[model samples]
Target: MNLGIVGQAVGLFAVTNIDDVVVLALFFAQGAGRRHAARNITVGQYVGFAAIVAVAVTAAFGATFLPERVVPYLGLLPLAIGVRAAVRVWRHRGRGGQEEDERTGPGGPRLLEVAAVTFANGGDNIGVYVPVFATAGIVGMSSYVVVFLALLALWIAAGRYFATRPVVARALSRWGHLLLPMVLIGIGVVILVDGGAFGL
Candidate 1:
């Protein structure tokens, strides 16, 4: 458990997941301003991140081979999600349908919904993590995972803080429909370009 591994993990996670703060803020804004909502979001993020880590660790161990070429394609998951959100807002004028109502109501967010969004948001994370984990032996990987999980809590807290800020929350609530989709699509394009996935 080298301290260097821990530091690297923290830096890697923070850099790779900076956008997650915005995404989490959006999800938290959808909350009913209740603790349960925040709790669910936290749990969902954990579940999604755990899934990514599992796959990444497997790939690291040679149990799987998710080629670097596949990294950019993962962007499609978030792109589709963003398109759906945009369409929903357009059709309903931001008033949302029954499904939207359910999302914002007292019952709070469903675990699966949060998990799916979290997983989709982390599509790029897998690409960054696989190589890091592969390079790090088990001891290094273990340290990295520990630091990442700890930082994950900070992400949830930061999201909650943003949600509580009236200015940020209002802005997100008012414009998230348009902003979220654009952000998602932008992320996808970045991945494709950065990875040169198209070899263009």
Candidate 2:
């Protein structure tokens, strides 16, 4: 149980997940008027992140069938999601704000939907996690999981705090429709480039 390894795990997770905070903040703002918004997001994030950890740990073990190059293509999931969101916003612009609000109501974003987006957004983490888990023994991996889960709670709180702020929430509500999709697309491109999927 090296403290250094724990520190490294925390650092790596925090650094890679910094962008998630922004995304999560937008989710919070989107669902601000919804009941169980925080709970839904918390559950969704855990489910989504658990899938990521499962994949990374499995790869760390003996499942080397999936190539490192192919992992980058997973970015397409988020890219598609972003494009869909952008289209929805565009269509809603012609329909009117009330229609959009009714469609995406207080109970709009379901747990599975958020989970899907979170999983998609988190696809890039596989690259970092696989290499880290390869070197980490069972205890080290366990430590990483514990630290990550704890930090995840903090991350949720931060997003909720931002969403609760009147000015911040209003700003996000106003501009998030335009920005979130672009951000997701950008994340996908970064993942693809970083992974050198097409040798580019």
Candidate 3:
């Protein structure tokens, strides 16, 4: 109900998730024309984001589901995923008629994969959200959560739109598989550096 709270929620979500747009786009590109791709992505995004919010809310309420010291290690999730993707790409390269392998390999961006990546990418979000939720009263927090969920649909739509664009779609179709590993690896490295995970 408070305009201030609504604005803050919007800003925070945008700032934290702008990168997610690109990631989601890549996923859409990879999933283009595949059965259940959109549904898997949508469900995965919600599941992943919901986990992040739950962690933040729990921490705000004084529960340490994940200790602060352990937060940085969360980067391992993405890092491992990226490495695995890269390895798969390498192994399957030049193996023609492997479209099915490409699609079904490692389960092909299914709900669990997307959810894991989303959750992994959201480590920083939890850090940002915990303090905000702590300060926000129950009403404010609820508003923020509602706005976040609603905007999530918009984010998915935006990603799909970008992926469907003529030029972007072509590029993604050609290079999406390649780009995926790089992006995931890059995200993992950034999270690790930002969280000082390596030092720990």
Candidate 4:
């Protein structure tokens, strides 16, 4: 593994996934105290990321899986999720603990749900990774993959740390249900606009 390649991989992954920290933190906040919440989020993140990497690697090999214009359609996943969340909150308003209960209900956060969100949030990552991976030869690709996986663990730890901080946890516990939907919606909108979907 060339040190230069390692450094480049680290920098690229960090730049692409910086926003994931906040998103993961929000997930942890909502999943706190629920059974298997952390595990679900972690596994989901890895699964989603693995999918993105698979796509990028495939594209790098001369097989295009997604056209640029279609990337923005991915935003619909998060937008629908956010809308569903908002509707749930609205429907349960004034139910006195029911809302929170539903939000953090028995299943915790579903692994697939988390995975979908992670993947949806990673359109930019795919765009960035495809070119980088394409330029990296076999050896360099291996190094990049290893480094990216390692950094993903670090990102998870950081998110967990933030979610567990007393002040942040308190605020999130109180408002996470509401904030999460809004954040998801906002992320969707940003993706749509950034990708020029629907002409911004």
Shift of residue 1 alpha carbon in model 1, Å? 4.3
| Residues 78-140, model 1: lDDT tens digits | 667667766766886745565455654464445766676677668668877888899888988
lDDT of 4 by residue, 109-146 (tens): 67987888888899778888988888888888888999
Q: 1-200 in candidate 3: lDDT tens per residue? A: 89998898999999999998999999898787677888999999999999999999999999979887777777788788889889988987888567645564344578988898899899778988998999997999999999999899999999999999999999998888899999989888888888898693
lDDT of each: 0.76, 0.78, 0.88, 0.87
Give the per-residue lDDT digits (tens) of candidate 2, residues 1-200.
67988799789988978878887887787676667777888899889888888888888886965576677777776677778878877878876667545634557445876677777677878778987888888889888888888888898898778877889878887787677778777877777777776776
Residue clash pairs of candidate 2 = none
Best by TM-score: 4
Residue 82, model 4: lDDT of 88
> How many Å off is the CA of 31 in candidate 1?
2.9
* Candidate with the greatest lDDT versus the true structure: 3
Q: What C-alpha RMSD separates each model from the true structure?
A: 3.4, 2.6, 2.1, 1.6
lDDT of 1: 0.76
CA shift of 175, model 2, Å: 1.1
Candidates ranked, most accurate by lDDT first: 3, 4, 2, 1
